[model samples]
Target: MNEQLLKDLLNQDLDPVETREWIESLTAVIGADGPERAHYLLERMVDETRRAGGHIPFQPTTAYVNTIPPQREAQSPGDAAIEWRIRSMLRWNAMAMVVRANRKPGELGGHISSFASSATLYDVGFNHFWRAASAEHPGDLLYIQGHSAPGIYARAFLEGRLTQEQIDHYRMEVDGKGVSSYPHPWLMPDFWQTPTVSMGLGPITAIYQARFCKYLEHRGLIPESDRKVWCFMGDGESDEPESLGAISLGGRERLDNLVFVINCNLQRLDGPVRGNGKIIQELEGVFRGAGWNVIKVVWGSYWDALLAKDTSGKLRQLMMETVDGEYQNFKAFGGAYTREHFFGKYPETKALVAHLSDEDIWHLNRGGHDPHKVYAAYHAASAHKGQPTVILAKTVKGYGMGEAGEAQNITHQQKKLDDSEVRAFRDRFKLPLSDEQLADVPYYHPGEDSPEVRYM
Candidate 1:
């Protein structure tokens, strides 16, 4: 196209359809004439637009979608069904541990939503990425988010590392047998590798730990190996200056072995974290600007079909435009509300999801809850070289707790579930428990010889 024609096209306020056609035409031209000429022409158009005092729309540095496309995603190496079952069991036990503890006379407090939100994030790592310390290898160092200790304890219980009695004593560490409320090295020196309950400590410590690993290698104190430091933190936790203050150091030092997984559940203790804005986008700009490799896992596999069908990009536009508060409301209110408020915003967007029912929409998940997506991001992050990698995974706080919490502001303090909520939780996970068993809030464990045990 000529310069004047290009200028005219840019000046017009094209609708989505017209914009798509223009994009297709430009792509065809780029394919025919090669990228070099296309780049030059685009730069010239930008310069001309600026010279004419015309406003150019700001393009986001990242898309509001999974950084790794479906085609490029790594196939999960493990049996997904088995892994999901194990994860469900862990999630149930973790919630039950907190619920049962809170029901006691002392009302011992523990966290449910933190672990609930991060189950898949942790499961993917345990199944495919994280390594235990051993003689043969230096092993991966994990700074588990302090509030997520219950989930870790639940997994240990399944592995025969902790007895049922210890599992029963959550947040009762004053007695010698009980587990600590958070990951405290001094409390359980043999088990806990790091103390991370202080909110900002985990992120800073993990950065230094990764840097120190390189220092040890340089000093010839340890052989150069593929040991990684995995730091898990919440979006709220990132608000702490200590959490984000030293990220530039990790980038500057080229701590390729460092991986920070921030669970962007869009929630803090009181309410939504960045309620009016997108936290994932904000953090992406920060990390990428700081010279780090940032991978975003926003939508789950359930969204792949819808996104693929969004030829006009209307669906993505809606996703980008919607704020965190609205997103959390969509989860809290369920599918029917989401259809009306989210897709119903535009005729084109509404028609896109028209074939799906309310139940289908409600079941659609976020990336952090999906093992395949989480695994793909983890796989890519592990292989990434030069810069540190940070995975900004979107999830729902109090994921499966239903009305008792799920995505609510009260989720952080939700410890006990009433009879109906208990039943809902049971049915949601498809736990093999009867209605009568709901009252007791018993921890369901398949026998040692069960397939779940063998798989674990």
Candidate 2:
């Protein structure tokens, strides 16, 4: 290709169709010649464009879609029906534990939104990704977020690792039998591994842990193994300097054993983490610039059909242009508002979703909540080498909490749910509890012979 002709083409204001054709042609030439030659030419073009002060259009670092294409994604090995049933049971117990504690005279409070938001994130790991320590191999290390401890406890109860007495004593650690609100190695020395109750400790420590593993392997202190360090944190937690301070070290050291999963629920304790901006895009640029593998799990499987139909790119353009504040409101207000405002702005975008009902539109989930999408990202990260990996997963703050707190600014402090909210939650999770059983917001456990129990 001639340099001047390439410059002229770059300067032209081509529409989406023309741009697509130009890219396809360029890709064909690259494929015929070989990718290495094309890479050299592209680098030269970038340098020349900078020297000439000419504008160059680059692809966005991330897209409003899953990092892995549907065809390339691996199928989840676990049975979906059994896994969902187990997740529903855990979600109910976790919520019930917090609500029951607050009803006491002391009004002992615990975080509801964090766990509600991240239940699927944890559930996926438990079922497939995370492994236990054994004589043959070292196990994966997890740094659970401080606020999401309740969900872990609920899982333990179902596994028979925790007793009902411990479940009842949430946030009242003074008693010998009571459980601590956050992960504490001292309180539960036999169970909890790392202490992450402090806001920014998890991320920094997890990075060093991965680095330390490499150090031990090089020193011949431990056998060479594929153990991984999994760090889970909130989007708001990233604001703490400690959370992102050591990410550069991870990339520089080529710590392929490390995987950081940041749950972006949008809302922090007070309000939106970045109401005016896109946090996922910002983080993507930072990680990619640092020479780390970045996988974005933005939209869920529910969006596959609509995204496929969005040939004009208008729908995606709207998704990119919308701010976090508006996204939060769309979920809070429901499907009607989302269709009216999100799609209402452009007739072409509106028509793309015309076949779906308001209810269908409302249930369109974020990527973090879907097990298949989460599994794909995890599987990819585990297999990727030569760099660290970060999965920026988008989720709803108060995920199944209904009007009590879902997507509301008051989520962090929402410790108790009313009778109607409890009933709604039970129904949403498809729990077997009747209205009468839900009256007390009691903890539920399937018998030992039940499929859920046997599957676990």
Candidate 3:
């Protein structure tokens, strides 16, 4: 931990053993891969070493990313190309910092620092897909943005195709002509957590609970209604004290319309005693037991089928029929507890009945819960009735960052990336030669601002 030792470590020559250790450690922190374009951060590590006034220490192994499933036997044909395009573009965004850093070293290192916040990701994510989704199935999503995430989101959407109305609204505010500036560089919605949490949760966490109730009542998905509301979340927000408790309450209240998509890859906010230990342990199991449909898609699997064009059609069809608000109750178990057998256990635990004549998902007109029974009653009542909802996904921490040595937690993440490691990762993103490709391009950096935003 001393400066000399740290410097020495930075200067150390790496072997296969050391290289593997370094990559795994990075993956644990970044969660998915740092950037798919990079097999290793080659140039950045050297830059980091030079900045440290030492030699680069850690190195990367010769490995390839395999985040996607093969498209050979797929019902879809273009899924493969689309999948790769997505990966490459995401990776391109990741290195936006380094690519832009040369203009202003360390100034525009926005993606990593800016991205860990749930608010920022939400806004950016919206910008990334608004054109495709909103233009297509307008009714399917009513995306909400409150804090830091929404600001990024708003900007991202504007960048895609700026409009006079939209631009006028946000620009007035960021500029003096408006009222307040966007929350911090990052915004934390109502339930957002601020720095420091050693004691426990406070007011920010309170409103989060209140809004959950309101949002669910207002916009929740009904089996027959065919609507879905997604709450974009950050690592800090994910750790909110009341979050899981509220999610359980949602299930208890039969709010199957609510879907929680948590971004869990950031290491800075994810302390050890929390992130994987408590957060994942609780959410991964919480709602499934209480009559909720949970789908945990991690790695490249995060929000894929639902957002994809070719697959979106099938996804919508499956979801609509599944929730057609018939005359029966059903329980869906996905993620960790998924199996083919839960389909039959309904006969004994039938505590509820479906009575609705309208279209709805999990449309329960009547149900009886034994005061003596625990969540088991709800579990049985749900899984027994309707077509039965299913939790489609769950992911391992750091799904494909390629790190295996360290536990995916915060304490380790607090440490800085060494020079050699940075360089290795930067170089790994180098694109293959193409005769027709443009001659002028930009460099990739992990901690620099984006050139794509400027001199494009």
RMSD (Cα, Å) of candidate 3?
24.8
Off by over 4 Å in 2: 1-21, 27-60
lDDT of 2: 0.90
TM-score of each: 0.91, 0.92, 0.37
> Cα lDDT of model 3 overall?
0.32
Residues 1-456, candidate 1, lDDT per residue (tens digit)?
875457457668456567768778779878899767777888888989989999897544587999999988998989988887888889999988999999999898889999999999999998788888789898999999998999999999888898788989998878789898899889889789888878999999999999999999989999999999999999999999899999999999999999999999999998999999999999999888888999999999999999999976779989999999999999999999999999999888999889999999998999999999999999999999999999999999999999999999999999888999989888888889999888888887887888888977
Worst 10 residues of 2 by lDDT: 2-11
* Top model number, lDDT: 1
- Writing each residue's lDDT as its tens digit, candidate 3 over 165-277 gives 33223323444332122332233232122321221232233334434544654675422433333444433454556444455455554554344444443333343224223
Better of 1 and 3 by TM-score: 1
Task: Using TM-score as the measure, name the better of candidate 2 and candidate 3.
Answer: 2
1-456 per-residue lDDT for model 2 (tens digits): 975456457668456557668688779867799666777877897989988998887644866667887777988999998999999998899999999999999899899899999998999999898899999879999999999999999999998899899999998878789899898999999889898868889999999999999999999999999999999999999999999998999999999999999999988888999999988888888888777899999989999888888876778889899999999999999999999999989988899889889999999999999999999999999999999999999999999998998999999889999999999999999998888888899999997788998888
State residue 377's C-alpha deviation in candidate 2, in Å: 0.5
Q: Quick one: ranking by TM-score, best first?
A: 2, 1, 3
Ranking by lDDT: 1, 2, 3
